[model samples]
Every structure is written in structure tokens, then in C-alpha cells.
Target: MKITTNMHEGRRTEMYACGAWNDMIITDYLEMAVTKTPQKTALVGYRVHAGDRSAMSYSELDRRITRMAAGLAALGVEKGDVVSCQLPNWWQMSALFLACVRIGAVCNPLMPIFREHEMQYMLAHAQSKVVVVPKIFRHFDHQAMLQGLRSELPDLKHVLVIDSDDEQSFEQVLLQRAWEEEVDTARLFAERRPSADEVVQLLYTSGTTGKPKGVMHTSNTLLSNIRPFSERQGLSATDIILMPSPLAHQLGFLYGLMLPVYLGATAILQDVWEPAFAARVVAEEGCTLTLGSTPFLADLVDIARDEREQQASLKTFISAGAPIPGALVEKAASVMQGTKVISAWGMTENGAVTTTRPEDPQTTAVHSDGVALPYMQVKIVDGEGHEQPAGEEGDLLVRGASQCVGYFRQPDMYQLDNEGWFATGDIARKDATGYIRITGRSKDVVIRGGENLPIADIENTLYKHPAIQAVALVGAPDERLGERLCAYVTLHDSSATLTLKDVTDYLVEQKFTRQYLPEYLEVLAALPRTPSGKIQKFKLRDMARDIFQGQASHA
Candidate 1:
């Protein structure tokens, strides 16, 4: 495929590459997988009693990807076009992603849970040409929602509906025979493939602003992370991958789909977050490698405890998005049997930066977030952007191949310091051995159960409510989710009071997703502040924790 760099239609490869992505692209890996292991179990999914329902071989997946690419071309999706997909971990998504790279279109995967509040900003900003959504996922009517959003997104020409009753059916259109008789599928596939350095993925991450930031990543940058991370854990084609995390999230996006293709392994998809189902999939599919948040590991441990013998063939479990405690690691080995629990740390811009290797001591995996991958560099920095000494608790910055070139539409937002370091906005410390430990986040966002809540956006939206005089959204400590959002609000009048129901209703009207709505509401007479008139968020966090846990609010 011809190279398309950054947020535009045409740019030189040198503009973004720095010096990578010359030899191959993402689809090349799938091509290699098919060539090397034509009959190998390439993809697997679902843990329904019916068995591992979604399973596909290497050649079978390749054929589907080819057809889907041609089908997308028939639907007016050209090179450099953005195809936005908001889907669950269905078997079709894998083919769709491969199809995008094959047809030279950018793959934009949005969270299935993203409501109009999140979708509107990203879709419009990206100027996506074609959008694919499930008819109904988890009781949400995405088909109707995208249809309603059409007027707002003028560039959105096609809205493909998955498993639906319509002329524009997702499966019927993308996976069926070539739709356009004039176009030859073979020639189209050969000519439309993208360069390895082209911006193949246009993903969105939560930002300080109400809107989401679109992060652009190339095939090389993404593979740089996956190739090393998987190799470090000794992943192979024989391994079965159980992907419990949502494919929309970066963790699942890299390891869930791309990593499997890279390994030529079978990937089992669990659409929903059900621990029992996840465990069942692992056992049935003989899943060996999986990566997700700490909560996932915790839930799986609980699920394993009920079993007399370990049925699952789990080898490595890399828990990320939060810290993994020592207690959980010891318990996992006993209950999960053969599974080795590891920890990882990274974000949307960089896929998997640091990960505890299979060789590291179990204790190191439990405490530290692990050493940086070969494709990247990690260092702690002070407020003035100077590199901090080892063991100094300061801001964490990472630079290297796995990092995204820039943010889509908002290139200015992708700022880097003089040394090419990108501030992670996370306060962390690197040990003398190069292992990093995350202390806290400087960004104003609440990462609940691995889903990032737009703290500033929610607070700003709530402030518009007439009854809310002052509002601060802070993450209160929680065992399961790591942290839960709590809204500390002061009413306009003494008689006016805000309840959880009141805040939920107000946020709902603002088009915020239910997941982002605060679970607890702390009504305060006045918000505590520093001497200089800045809001003391630390004080509010304490109050939120106190109120949420049924303790008395000191304020």
C-alpha cells in the first residue's frame, strides 16, 4: 500500500517513520501466518455451553479477509479512508480489521460502550467515511444511534449493521462475494494494501477535555510492541489466546487481535466481562496466553478456586491497567495451577511498553510494572522535564518505536519534549534494575475497572446543572475496580440536595455513558481549597473515600 502519514491523505514515509516500517505491514503478518500454518487454528471465540463457537483456521481467515477487503472497496471505501467500527469481541471484527489494512483504509475501533457523548466527538473529528456497528450490543441499539448520528457526520457515507435485517448488512456486505462486478478482487487486494508505516489505526483515548483524543498508529509501531512482548513471554503458534478484555481497548486491540495474527495462534474472544465464561473459554480452548487488567486476574482466580483440577492450559497471564499485588500472585499460582501471572504497563499511544517477563521472579512481577520492552525506553522525569534519578518518584516519560507518530486531527496535542520524551502523565519511579513502579496519575481521569472515565468532562458537564454550585469528580478507592468515581457537589441553595439518581439523570441527558456516571455522591457545604484558591483534590478524594465506605465525612 502507498504510505499515508499523520492525519492527512498524503505524506512522505520519513515524516513519521524516524526509521521503521520499510519491509512489511500488518496484513503481511497475516499473509505469513497463512503461508506458514495454512491449517493452524488462527482464531477462536465464545465460551457458550455450545462450546468454543467462534473458531477459524489460518487459510479460512485469510480468505475472509480478502473477500472483506474487496467488499469494502465495492462500498466506496477507498485508500486513506477511515472505517470506524464499534463492535464487541465478535469473530467478524478480526476479519474487519485485517480487511482495513488490506484495502488501505485506516481501522478505527471505538468502544461498544461509547455513547453519543463519546462517539460524536471522535466520528466527526476523524471524518470517517464508513462506520460499522452492531444492531444491538448489550441492549444498546447502535444501529439506530449511528443512523441518528449521520446528519452530524457528513463524511460518514456508509453505516454497516452487524447481524441485522437490512440491505446494508455487515456480514452480508463485507464477508460475502465481491459486490462490485467491475472490480477484480485479486487486483484490488494487491494494489490497495498499505505501507507498513502508514497510519493503519486511528484510535481514541480519554482526554482532559470533554472530547476524546484520536491517536494515530502505524503497523510497524504497533507490531514493535506485540512482537517483543509476546516473544518475551515465549508465545508461539501452538498457544491459544483467551482475550477477555474488550477489543476496543488498547490492551485487547494489540494483544487480542494483532498479537494473535503475529503469533499465528488461535485467539478466543469473550465479548462480555463474565469470569466464569472467561474461565470456561480458557478450559475449552486450551488458552495459554492472555493479558488484561488486575480485576480480570482476580476474577479468574476466584473462578479457578471452584475447580478440583485445572482444565485450562493457561501459561501466562499479564495483568495491566493497574498494579498487581503480591497476595494475588501467590494465590493465582495455587488456584490457577500452571498459569504464570505477570504485570504490564502502557497506553493508547504506545501499545505495551513494559511487561514482567516469564523469567522474572514471581515477586518482581507482583510488585514492579516490569522493565521496558526492547522497542521502547522508559524514564522518570521531574516537573521541569529533567530526567530524575533512579528510584525518584516523578513523572514517567517513554520514547521509541512503539509510540504513535501523532494524534489524528489534533496534531498539536501530540507534544514531545526536547529529548523526544512523551509524558505519560503518570507519576512513577524506575528502580536501579530498570523496573518501573506507578505511584499515581497526574491526569484528571478515573480509570475504573480498566475503563477510563472522563473526570474533567464529567465535572464540566455537571457544573452546567443549575442545582450544582460546585462539583469535583475524583476517584475513590475500590477493591474491584481499583478506583470508583465519586462526585462531590455543593448545591446552589441549602435546601437543594443532589442524590445519585439526580446526577445520573442529569448525566444521561448530557449523553454520558452509564459507566462514567459517579457511583457515589458526596454533598458538601463547601469544597476545601488551598491557600492560593486552588481546589484541593487530595482532600476531596479523602472525603469521597470516607463517604463511599460509610465513614463520616470530616468536612
Candidate 2:
């Protein structure tokens, strides 16, 4: 786990001394829960195989983590090693986090949607020693995919498959056998227990560049955000969290898994995002809270109205990754009578920086992404670094304990000023009371349904197509999803024509993730350009919006 650091040891010690970061790691909390509430249900995972719903109690989870950590150690995983897992919301993911903590290994969680194109670079860059994957997910053979990649990854020693019944499967190798019995337990703990300041998690996020940047987080930085956020949401030990967002993402990793462990509460995970299924789970599990994007809220509101037998105990819905449309907030209030829909704004670099409180006026969620949480600061500054007056949009900057340590293996990419403020590539305006409304992004990327699509990567791949002369990918307005990818293209030959299917097929041939293929294609004679020959993407965005609105109205 070689990675970059934003703060030196002196600065970190100073922050800790000032009480910005607590000394306890997540494992400390897990042990506390095991001692205090050993019989309480700690996790419930709705896995993809056979629609199985699995639950694990605190004591049982701790025992499995000990075994799994020993098993990993026996397989040559040492302190400061990088262990990557490309898994969905599952019991294995939770166990792996604890196991990594137990062994002082860095945990790198990859999104299940990433294929060979994305996986190869991330794993290779991180120099991951081992990787865990499902045998198959969403009809894709993950084990087979990793098998194909292993020859190229010299550092990737072990490939553990979760649901396989073979000799090398996760169940047979890590769970069934008690490896801890063979190892010196006292020596392992003495040698491997990680400190609060050590980097524990490496998560990849889309940026303006074609390659995704790996955001690094220690237990202290992550919990710094989670503690304040859970407090503001009125969460407690008795609350059960119903999480539908992918656990690999920061939103789910913090609130779904880590938050529950922090509070000694139960976490119910839904691997697939089906509105009806989620509503049913909430009713069955007595879920009191959840955090997701606008799309999940929209679907949940739609399904909750028609399902009469499902008794939803859901109290709070914290929406992030996209703006909560005002109309949707009103509609949610109408359908889901008792639930509070809160708007939150943050990125992978800093988790949950701003979120409207549950006690705030209901309409507050419609317009603001709330003020900064405790120990965090958010300010809007102009290009010249001067602070902007209230209500004026400028580059959004943040500095806090919750900010990530730095990007992994990319020291030059880490941008922080002398004052420790990291410039987030978002344009926003702050109100007099310190609420921020994100107006636009300065980064060249598109966020589709809370997942940020790699815009430069897609455009670069499309540029390789022989039939295309110029291409730009813009996000078109979507009602359910916040935006859909729209590819605007000009042909190399005026007589040649390209359709949406053609573009998608070419992208698939290039091994692009099919989920991100552009939904709309517009063939223009020439893309709008500045006099200096730069692509005028703002004009293209307006065009895409009008075209999509027009087509949607006709439909």
C-alpha cells in the first residue's frame, strides 16, 4: 500500500490533538459491538444467487473475520498489502473489510459494473496482491474475467471466487476451515493492528481525465464524516439501515456498512436496485433509514404507493450524488407520508460534506445541499482565489477531517493549497446562511444516476472509430435518472451515416462497459467550436437538452 499523502505527520498529529480525528478505528468499534451486543443481527445481505437473504450476528461476524484474516495471512497477505474486491452488496464484502482491518491490509473495493477495460488498470496500478470476486454476477462470469486478467497482473497472487463450490472458493477456503487455530493469534494482533492515521481504503472515482483517480481514506477521515452525518440524520443504535446503493461506492461504504458498525446497528443490503424489492425489504427488516441518489427515491416513491401489503417503516431518505428535484420532493411527501427526503452533496474525495438536516424545513431540501458538517468547511472562490459573495457561483473548495488522504500512486494529481483547501471541480453558490446550491461542474464528466461516467475515456474510445471525425459526450436531462449520456458526432465522410446502434456496437467491440454506452446519438455537420478551435460543449449541452425534451414530449 504505497500511496500519496496530503498532510504530513505533524499536521495529522495536530488535527488529532485538536480532536478532528478520533483514535478509534472501525475494528475497535466492531470489537465493542461484539462485546456489547453479540446476539444482535449485524448484517443482512440479499445476494444475487438464488435470491438468498443471509443474516449474520455480531459475534458470528467477528469470528468469521478472525478466520478470514488468518486465512488471508496464511496465503501470504502481509501488513500494508493491497487486497481488492470487485463485489456487490454482500456479506462477504462486510467480512472482507473487517478481515482487512484485522490484518492491516488496505481494502480496495471495485464497482461490480467495471469490466476488463477498467479493472485491468485499477488492479495493476494499485498493485493489488489479491482480489475477490463473485463466481458470476448479473449473468457475467467474474471469475472467468479475472482469470483472463491474472496473467497480466504479476502482483495479483490469489483470485478468490465467492459462490463457487470448488476447492479454491471463498466458502471452502476461508469460512469452513478454522485457520486461526494454526496461527499465533497474539503475535498477529501485536504485529498487524493498524493505527488511525494509516490508509485503510482506496476507492476509485471518475475525474476529468480518462483514467479514474484512486481516492485514499483512513478510518479516521471516513468516520470523521460518518459520525457527524449520522448524528445530523438522528440515527442511533436501534436504527436499521436499508441500503440499495452499490456498497463499493463511498455513499454505501460509509452509510450502508461502516455507519451501522459505528452505531452498533443492523444493516440490510440490497445488491440489486429494484424499487418494489427495496420497499418490501424495508417493510420486512423494519428499516428506518437509507441513503441513495434521486433515482432510487423516485422509484421508491412510485412503488410505495401501489404496494399495500408492504409496511414501510422507512423514516429518512438521504439523497446524494445528484440534486433532488423540487417536484420529486413534493411528490415523495404526498406518497410517502412519514419519510423525510434530505438532499446531500459530496464526492468520493470527501464524504457527505453538506447535507440538509432532517429538522430543516422540508422545502429546504429542494434548493440547498445544506451547510458543511462538523469539523468541515466549504467556501466558494473565484478563479483568482478570492472568496465570492453570497449567491454568486464559483469554484467550490473544501477542507476538513473528512477529506481523503490523497490519490493513490498519483502524487502530482493531489491538489491542496497552503491552507489545506482542495478545489472541488464543481461550480456552486453559497447563501447567506451557508447553504450551497451546486450550479454546474467545471470538470469534464457526466454523472448518470449517481454514477459518474468517464467522459474523456468514452470520447477517446469513440475517437478511435474510423468513421468518426469528431465526438463529444454530453449529459441530456432525464426525469428518473438525473442525466443520460448523449453523443454528438460529425462524420469523417459527409456521405457516411452513423446510428445509435452503430456507436454502441463499436464501443462494445472496444470492450467499453455496456452500461455507459450513450443512449442518444446526434449527427451534426460540425460541432460548435470557439474561434480558437476549442469544442463549445455548453452549446452542445443546450442542444442535447432541447432534443431530449422534444423527443420525450413526443413519446
Candidate 3:
């Protein structure tokens, strides 16, 4: 599926002319590093519990990527084919993406947290030809799940499992042999070098109000953000990146995996978020930079305060997906003496569009998201489409080189205006100096840590319960995670009872992701509704906030 259009061509020309896009695919960068820094450490993966660590140099990693590409080709994967991978932050996950680039195929990375509920929709919608998963991750049998799903998805022809030595294991099939030598190297490069405009990533974002839409991005669009964003942050080949965020999310994919490759830098991957483990790794590796959500910073601060030596080598921490509280920023600065905590805001549609600068006051991130990167534009507009004055909260909209091409197989769902602006569904205010402060979301979303919960999907599932007559999901205040999901329900019969555990049990039985289950449940006689009978979620949100505040005060 080619995603290019006249509009895309026009954008590409504009971006290239202005140097927002350098017109180089990620594989080109990998090859450049292979020739220039062949012996440099390109990747370091840590599997803490399994007591395993792997490191690969640039040249060795490139060779492995080529072999992996040949393995995919041997499985009948070709140009434009979608290859989905549901793996953890292991070395193989990073290699798989680069291999997709080598073979000119679209790569779709699914979060390991996703179960049959989300996988069924995403795999079938993307029409993936190949899916790679772990034999078992976190005690869940991923191989079994995919095997069960295979019969339902006719497009899924191959299921390759990682962390296993079986016939279908990724290492056995893709790594044990030198398949690159068997393939016609000259013809493979000549026939399969993908253009920068071709869609390289298909990321399905958890929706706030509807089914997940597959966000499609090309090399030019993704690299557009990486180049300027990294430059502004003063990242270089000398710096080491310690990434604990999930590789499946854009935070880890763009920065943890792609950014290091782009800069010829080293990336240290941590598959799980253990603050003590992360702190130790950063010090041991001398990692200089990292990016994650507010919760990560909070946990790191807690650890650094107790073990100051663990975070001594850290230089930068960029927080996104939620507002950074001023108190937390102060605490982090106090504990990690030289580390700069930068604030940023963006979506899956576009990578980090705005971020606080290193030279700015430490408090700037507390008050505002930051100024837009050079290649992007941000504006706040009223309901009538007029630009709002500074300090006035309005709809947040953004557009630029980093904006995704369109939604996969759902062009009409993109809904960018004629001028190329995309509505962000966020309400925010812009200062006279252009920094934006996110006030609230026009869309109902519960941002637990850095992940957006699928509110509509969860609510719809709850509606199927025999006891529920009405249900509304809202985000409740939480200092560490920014927000925790709260569910308010009205029972079918006045005497019908419901408890938080009961609600969680039902959702789990329905295959809902455990991490997204509501932390609090409220049983009400009737949900607050407007005169016209529409549910007033704002009222429920306020109630949740009041209850949370009360609990905090009592404690």
C-alpha cells in the first residue's frame, strides 16, 4: 500500500527545500555508521531478571539486520508488505525494525501489553503477513495466543517467536545462518531500496473515543522530528541514551532506537521500568540522556535521593505525554544535581513538536510545554476557527514536516484541514512568547503514566455487564502517574450491587488489558446528565478529583 499523494509530494518538497527532512532513510544512517564507526557499540540490551546482556557493534548489527531481512524475504515478505512485531525491548525488536527498512516493508510494532482484544483488530486491519512474538513474556504465552489467532486471520502467514530455540524462533530462523550470502546482494539493494516517502511505520494509538486508528509515518516525517529535536536537545554521538520506556511506543522507538542510530550514538535498553535498576544502569553505562513520562521522572527522583551516586552521570531527562508538576521538577533538580528535566508535548501523529530548552529556567517546564521546534507550528483556535489570543485556552492544533502522512486504510479519518493543520483534541493556552500550557483535553482520555487508555473500548465492554445500566470512564488525579482511571456506573436494578473487584474481573474476563483497569469505582443511583439526557462526564471528573483530594488529605 503506497501512501503517497500530491499533497504528500508537496509537503516533501517544502520540507526538503527548507532542510526539515534530509531525505535519508534509517538504513542509510545504519550503513553510514557501519563504514564510519564499525567497532562502536551500537546497542546494549538488558534483561535484568534473566541475567542476560547483549551488545552489538555497528557493523555486526548491520550484518544481523541484513540477515533478518533475508529471513523475512524467505518467508515471502516483499515490498509494501506489513510485518507486525509484538516483542519487548530486546535486541531483536530493534533489529526487526531496521530489517524491515532493508527489505522495503512497512513495520508495525504492537505493544506487548496488548492482548487478544487489541491484537485481533490491529493484525487484521493492517493485513500483516508476518508477526514476531516472544514464546512467553511476563508469564503470558504469546506464541500460543498468536497460534490461536492465526486461523482467524488469513493474512497472517508466519508467526516467529523470540526467546526460543525452536524451528520458528527468530534466532534459529533469522540469525543462526548466513542467509545474506545466499541472496543476490546487488539485485536486493537495486530492487528494494525504499524511497524516503514510503510509509515505514504503522502505529495504532489507543483511542480516547473510538477504535484505534493506525498512524502511518514515512522516513522523512519521522526523521524530520528526530533531527531538529535532537539538535535542540544537544544530543551527539558521544552521549549514551538509557531508555526504560517501552520500545513499542513512539518515545522509545524515535529516541531509544532511531535517535541513537541517527546520531551514531549508543542506546542502552531496559525492558522493564525498575527505578533502582534504571538508576544503576545509568551510572554503570554513564548514560547521558533519556526520555519518558512524569512517572518515570518521579521514580528516578525517589531513587536518586536515596542513592545519589546512581544518577551522577545523567545529563538530561525529557518528559512528555503529561504535565510535569513544578514540585516534582524541583525535587528532581535537587536530587540529580546536573540533570536537566525538559518538558515536551506531542502525539503519535507527530513526534515531539515542542520542548523546553536546556538554557531555559528550570521552572519553564512547570508552567509551559515549551516553544515549537523549528520545523513545526502550534496554534490555539476558538470554536469558530479564529486564532485565540495568548493566555486564552482553546483547541490545540499543529502541523508541519513531522505530521504523519495519514491513517492507514482510513484516509478520511485523518481529518486535517485544507491548510494542513491537525486538531489535537487538547485544550491549551499559548503565552505571548509561544510556549503552550495544556489545560485540559477536549477528548476523554486517561493518561496513566505515558500511555493513553482506551476509554471508549473499556466503557463499551462495561456496558455488556448484566448489572451495569450506565458507565462512564474518567481520569482521576494522581501525583505519580498524572491520572488514574475511574469508573462510575449506575446499576440496572436499584438494589443491584457492584464493586471495583467485580468490575475488574468482568473486564479481565473480556480480555481488557490489566494495566488499564480502573483503580476506583463509584456506584451511583443515576449518572449526572444534562437536560437533553447526555452524560455529564465533567461532573464525574470533578467528583473523582474531589474524592482523590479527600483521600490525600486524610492520609
Candidate 4:
């Protein structure tokens, strides 16, 4: 692995340590804000739907956080406790996250889309004692889901519903309670804050394999990951960040929530991805920094192209989650004024591993995921784990302060074998200029426009259909979507009639979003299998490609 320029300058090491990367935690940075600029607007949560806006000054934000910390303590949320939160991009989420850290609790932020099954798995695995969720959001029955999960999860004790139009409101808890009662406990506990190495967050990856693994991250790891990128991008108090990506994801949390607050900048939150609304946010709020997935960027570009007033304030548009096609990059550059489409590559295991530098040559941004951030090291290795020469496609490995501590409770899988590097599971090539380009994932996961759709989950869901005897979910290439789900179904009886619509409709009823639903379905008398009786998904994938191509031509 080659080290990039000035990557580890301010990194800390033990008295005898030699590495460039420092070990620090989230509190280290929060204290900086309190000490330097306590009067600045640390966070601002605007509810565009309700025409309501709220601002939190740095000092006030810190105060509210302390109060929330006290409140959590009253609920019996102790240190090392897993606090699950499924809220939108609101001020409460930010305040609660900081409060959790203040009390030495691991923050488990989950997507609001997660239903009973997903919530059950995450809550059970994390052993989350407290869950904070919105009462109802956009017609989704969140309260019902919480009710269903309470019985299944014995460890779960406290259920705090945010934005509830009821007596048990988040405000009532803070306003009605005697702050003096818990203030000393919170302050005393805050004094004994966890070290940088202690896990601050247990972020679960949207697994494309078995169950999702909880990626544990410490404060030092997160700060090290963000410092270089923040400094490099010149994130400051003047900048206003517009993030459409769900805060549950790393990019959204780091950039949308943490980065802006860390830099004394304002973070504009949008509950849903509405392009017209996104453009309005940029134009109206004077948003200078925006981060999202490829599809989100595409939608923004389309909306901006349609609305002439859009993109007047956007300066940097960070694209991650999946590859940003060169054509879309060019299109965005042409459509938006003073905006650059920057591609980034990373995972839940490590935040923002690689990114295209803003000042890099146009060719660099177009061809690479940019150079490694300061303090990070990258390498390409063969199947035998030997280093590959420059420009050769191999498994991408990275080691940095930002790298995750390890999978929660899965210690055996955490350590890097002799090499002191974590396998990124991405196949990439490092050029002479230190630019890395992602080619594919080493795992059998499908990147459908940035969201990793696990094949096994879809297959398992499909198997529930009574008419379907066996199923294999595979990815077929698509220009627009990057990849579309294709399901190969073997019927229980040869005479049984099962159409593609039948499977799709059933999946819809099962609450599998439209994106996960298979675009093409093949009813096979018998699925092709290997000697081990394992259905060859690769063969089915090829068949899907041929079927899609034939259908395209016929149309």
C-alpha cells in the first residue's frame, strides 16, 4: 500500500507510536466546538412541510445535549447501552446522537424504511434498550411497527416517539422535568467520557450477504476520517450543506450532520428526495455543499435543467454509494453553474475511504475515485493476497484512522491478517498518479444506484411464495439504474402458471420496495445447478441479460 500526501500530519500516537494516523473520538471534536465557537449556529433543522424552522446555537446545542443526556439517564440508558434511533433528518436526531455519546452509549441510527423484520434483527442484534422513532411520517405506520417489535425484543425498555402529537412529547420530557435534578449526573458522567478507542456508533451495513453486520466506529476513527476531507474541501462556517441521502447512511451522517456542525456550517435536511424541493433548497437556502448517491445527483441535474433558477448556490456536489457515470458527470457540469461532480468510494466499515480531490485535474475526477485522503493508505492485491502492480485490477485494501474498529461482537473477523489493512471488498486499480478506480465488489452484492441490495434477502423473501419452489436473485446490467434485480423462479409444478407480475405484486405486498422487486422474472422448469445442487446464479444472470436484450429489441 502506498501512502498519499500529507495524510497523517496531526495524527496522534502513543509515546512510542510511529503511525501517522491519530486515535481520537467524537467528543474530542465536540469539545473543540464548545471551546472555540459556542455562540455560532451549530445546527439548524427546518421543517419545510410544516413551514417550521428551528436553530440551535453551539452553546444551546451543547446545553440541550446535556439535558438529553440527563433524560436518557433517567430512562436507565447507561454506558455501553445500545440506543436505537429511527428518525428523519431532524434536530432531535442530531441532539440525541450527541447525547448518546455524552453518556457513553453507542448510537444505533437506522433507516425509517425498516419494517418489523428489519427492526427486529437490528434491535435484537444490537440489544438496543431504547428506541427513538417518529410517531408517523408520510403515512408509514411507525407506531404500529414499534408495537410489534416491543414483544419480540425483550431488551428494549424505552420507546421515545419524536414528533408525536401526544402528551408524551420530546419537549415535555425536557421542559417539564427538573433540569437541576439530572444536570449533576450528566455533567459528572460527561467528565468521565469514553476514550477515543471506545465505540461511539454501531452502524449496521445494508448487507448483501447474510444478516447485516454492525460496523463499530470509535471517535478517533470518525474524526480521522473526516478531518482530511473537511480540510481539503475547505468546509467552513460560511458553507451550507444540502444532503438528501438518509442520515442513517455514513455519507449523510458524516457530511450532512457531523461535518457541518463540526465546521460551524448549517446543514439543510430534506426528509425525502424530491428534486424540485432539492433545487429549491439550494437556490433558497444558498446551499454551497451537497452530497448524495448517483441517482440523487441525476435527479438533481434533471430538476435543475428543468428549473432555470436551480443550482445558483451549489459549489460542490459529492457523489458516492456507487460509480458516477462519466456521461452524467459531464451533463451535471454543463447544467449546474459553479458545481463539480466529485466521485467518492467507501463503505460502512470505513467512512469516505477515497474521493476525487476538488482541485484535481478534470481527467483525474473523471477516471478515478480520486487520491486517498491525507493519512490513508491504499493497495491492490491478487487472490493470493500478494500486491499487484500499478493499474492492475485487484482487491482494494485500506488502513486509516477513519477505518472502523471492527464488526460489533465479531472480534475474529475484525483483525487484518499480517498486512495491517482491511479488505474493502472492492476491485480497483491504482494508477501511477495514485488515482484509484473501483471496478467491482469482491462480494456477491448488487449496487443498484448506490443502495446495496442483498441478493440473499430477496431470494429468501421470494421463497415465501407458495407457488415458487426455488429462486435465485441476480443482477443484470442496466445503463440508467446501474443494475436491476432479476429473479429466476422454479415452479412447484410444471403446469403451474406464475407470471412475472404475480411475483412482483407479491413482493410489493411483502413490503419489498419497487427497487428491490425484480424487473425480469424467468419461470424455469428446473434451475441450472452445479454438482453440489447450488443453483448457478451466474448462469441465470446471463439468461436474464439475453431476455432483457431480446425484450428491448422487440419493443
Instruction: Pick the lDDT winner.
Output: 3
What digit string (tens of lDDT, one per residue) describes model 2 on residues 29-94? 998999999999999988644688989899999999999999999999988899999998998998
Backbone clash count for every predicted candidate, in the order shown: 1, 0, 0, 8
Q: Where does candidate 1 have its weakest 10-residue lDDT segment?
A: 3-12
Please list the residue runs of candidate 3 whose C-alpha ends up more than 4 Å from where it truly belongs after superposition. 1-7
TM-score of each: 0.94, 0.98, 0.98, 0.91
Stretches off by above 4 angstroms in model 1 are 1-22, 47-52, 180-182, 548-555
- lDDT, candidates in the order shown: 0.82, 0.90, 0.90, 0.77
- Which scores greater on TM-score, model 1 or model 4? 1
- lDDT tens per residue, model 4, 485-513: 88788888889889889998987787665
- Residue pairs in steric clash, candidate 2? none
lDDT of 3 by residue, 1-555 (tens): 555432456777788899887769998889888999999999999987786789999999988888999878888998989999998889888899999988899999999999888999999999999999999888899998888788889999888998777777878888888888899855786588788888899999997778999998889899999999989999899999998998899988999989999999999999888888889899889999999999999999999888987888899999998999899999988999889999999999998989999999999989989999988999999999999999999999999999998888887788888888999999999999999999999997889998999999999989999999999999988889999889999997998788999999998898877987999999998899999999999999999999999999999
lDDT score, candidate 3, position 389: 98
Candidate 2 TM-score versus the reference: 0.98
